[model samples]
Target chain A: MNIILFEEKEISSTYHIQITDHRAKHIVKVLRSQVGDRVRVGVIDGGRGMAKIVAIKPKFPFSVDLDIQLETTLPEEKPVIDLVLALPRPIMLRRILSQVTSLGVGRIFLIDSQRVEKSFWQASLLQNEQYREHLLIGLEQAVATRLPEVSIYPKFKGFMDELLVKDLDDYSALIVADPAGTNTFSEALRQAGGSLRQGGRVLLCVGPEGGWVPAEVDQFSGCGFSICTIGERILKVDTAVIALHSRIMALREIL
Target chain B: MNIILFEEKEISSTYHIQITDHRAKHIVKVLRSQVGDRVRVGVIDGGRGMAKIVAIKPKFPFSVDLDIQLETTLPEEKPVIDLVLALPRPIMLRRILSQVTSLGVGRIFLIDSQRVEKSFWQASLLQNEQYREHLLIGLEQAVATRLPEVSIYPKFKGFMDELLVKDLDDYSALIVADPAGTNTFSEALRQAGGSLRQGGRVLLCVGPEGGWVPAEVDQFSGCGFSICTIGERILKVDTAVIALHSRIMALREIL
Candidate 1:
């Protein structure tokens, strides 16, 4: 576990972490961590700390005595890479959540695209916050302490013209994933370079499974957004996101 | 499978397919493929054909009668890109499979890296036909007919010496993945171009989880292998494979 997450109530007056919740079961039952075992712990929206187990109750509502100490604290200045993507099918949505969080993105703006399967948007996984849980699981795997804010945009043009570009004025770069566009990923990163310099507040756009219909692609292209291809192979959307970031990261000398 | 795989068989005048394995289960149970169902099929070491099923019986050794006609297939040559990689964990292996297939590589040489967990090699998923399953699945996704040949070399030195430089009378470009290497993926790809034009195989090596150690990097550099970085963020190996190919495929001008 990179950083074991906890809620505020888990912390005591002396800054000791009282193990509880699902993670508590994981530590005790699954991991079988005994007394004196070191367990990494961090408050969900709080500081990172590790606890040394001094005691345990290995049952429901389990508890563990804590001797907590802070380790590497994260920087408070969080940069967001909010993705505004057309909602994909349930299976693809599951993968996308993991990919976004694994890449350290901070927000998701799931928008409707003409090509997106109408039935896919209505999937139970999207309507409720179950996708949120999956994204959180990915974040946990990535050791990210922050969760990306997820918002759904049911309408396309209304979001693009009225809310997005206007409200996201601080964003230094905006990227859209389109197969037919001319610029390579390297070129896209060059355009996105401004975002890293200004801080990590950037916006990325990806289309649905069938891809943005010709009209939607035209609409996106008319904006200053550059289309970048990760490779000649037609990658699934989740693979594309990871592939896109990998290229961008390499160009920035951050591999 | 995007394209159902088949083995060559001399069937009855009706051209029956011996549906005795997983493919049979998939067709019968999953696809509910019945008599008169047409399916795309690729003959092993032969050509792709469409089969119209004539009959299906759940005999102890089940069989499906097929009327197959092979196509006038052009030989789509596999690029002489030999991948020398540290076997990534199972999770990473899935993406690597697809990425490698998409890159149009001819062969893969999986090696054990120092940083690679010993237990990873022990995973049953990497043994037997499991790895091939991953590759076939990936190839299907790309709608590509040819499957890359894979060779597993558990030891690093054997891979580097025998299968690598020893096979070369002419210069085979050697590029290794390194964060602080002599060049970037672009520079390295450029260097590989001259060798590629000379008509020898191109050998690209990607490191495992934490990457090749400094001494290993130095060893490759001494052997005239160019050390290159993908970028700043340490991407998972799966992402790196796709990203590396993204640039390489772009270098191919097929993008």
Candidate 2:
């Protein structure tokens, strides 16, 4: 983990906090931290800072208690990108959750689609605590404090017709990924008027393994979502998420 | 699999070929192909075409014999990007091989670096046939025929001092990824005089987990490698590779 993260409930006082979970064990065993060592630490959905190790007590099997002093607040930035993904297989969803969160997406909407397997909606990975766990893993890896909001939409039409239509104005642009799209992502951005770098929010929609159905594509187009392709290559969902996100982030910098 | 891949030796005659391997079983069971069914197929390091299932013999427990006609050819494209990566773990390497290959890299140099684990060089995953298996998987996924070349560099200094110095002129730009780099990738491309989109080859070097040491960074700088950062977030090696490749491909289209 790049930074040690603890929830608000874990803190006993303003400056002193006692950690007894896996994070404490990781600090003592994996990091080999000493009494006086200062390690990077962050509060869940709060701020990041250094934690000075004050006490290391090996009290239970496979566990330890660490007393640390929270030092300062980290410089934080607001998240600009949001993801609208068709629910993938449970295994791939878990990986995507961690990876995309680390890449700094502000929100995620795992919605159902014609190509998504019905069984995927029943997966326990979509549970609140489970999703939060994966998000925390990502936050720790990226050394970020803000937790991105994640929502599940088991019904496709309701999500698109009701929820999305209401929230469309929140984003500066809405883009959908399609292999046969005539516009490259760069051209899509240009057609949208300009880059998303000017503090504007973006909502990027990626399809399932089989890709968006013709009806779904038409629905997206009708809702004013620009269709763009990463290129000719058919990328797996996880890979495509990173590719599309990276491409946007890249263009936001130079365009 | 997007396209059924076969080694060059598997093509028996000018118009037809027979099969009785797992690929054949996959065609019969997973794909549910019968006589006269057409499946996309490609010859390794050759051309992509359609293979018609002329006959299906299910006499063996887990095998099927298929007679086919090779028809048509895929449009061939030249590779433009080359990768220089510090070898990741075996599991990650397997994914990297397929993923990077599908992204259309020309050559891959799995080189040792200061932060790279020595044991990584000893991984059986680096074995010729094993590596080729992953590459084939990538080609099958992307429906591409030509395979990218992979090379191993067990010794860091020697590869940098001997091979790299001698072959520096082959690529138009040499870029290295560093977290502390002042320039974003776009700025680096601008510094290199323009876009790599005009058929110019690019060599992208990504550091190991902990990143390149000062000495290694200095050596790269001495050899005219422009240093660029993806951003503030620390990305895992696999994520970084896709992100970097995606960024380059995106810029190639716009700039």
The interface RMSD values of the models, given in order, are 4.4, 0.9
lDDT score for residue A45 of model 1: 47
Leading candidate by TM-score: 2
What DockQ results for candidate 1?
0.23
For each candidate in turn, give its C-alpha RMSD to the true structure in angstroms. 5.8, 2.1
What is model 2's C-alpha RMSD?
2.1
Write candidate 1's Cα lDDT for A42-83 as tens digits.
Answer: 655456667888888887888767777767556223535667
TM-score between candidate 2 chain A and the true chain A: 0.92
Top of the candidates by DockQ: 2
lDDT score for residue B162 of model 2: 65
Please give the range of 10 consecutive residues that has the lowest summed lDDT in model 1 chain A: A246-255
**Deviation (Å) of B174 in candidate 2:** 0.8
The residue pairs in collision within model 1 are A106-A148, A249-B231, A250-B230, A250-B231, A253-B232, A254-B231, A254-B232, A254-B233, A255-B231, A255-B232
Docking class of 2: medium
- Per-residue lDDT over B1-255 for candidate 2, one digit per residue giving the tens place of the 0 to 100 score: 788888778777665677778788778777888788889888777777788887787555545444444554543575788999998988999998898888888889989998898888788888755788888777777778779888788888877976566778878778899897777787677655453655778899999888999898888988989988868888889888988988877776666
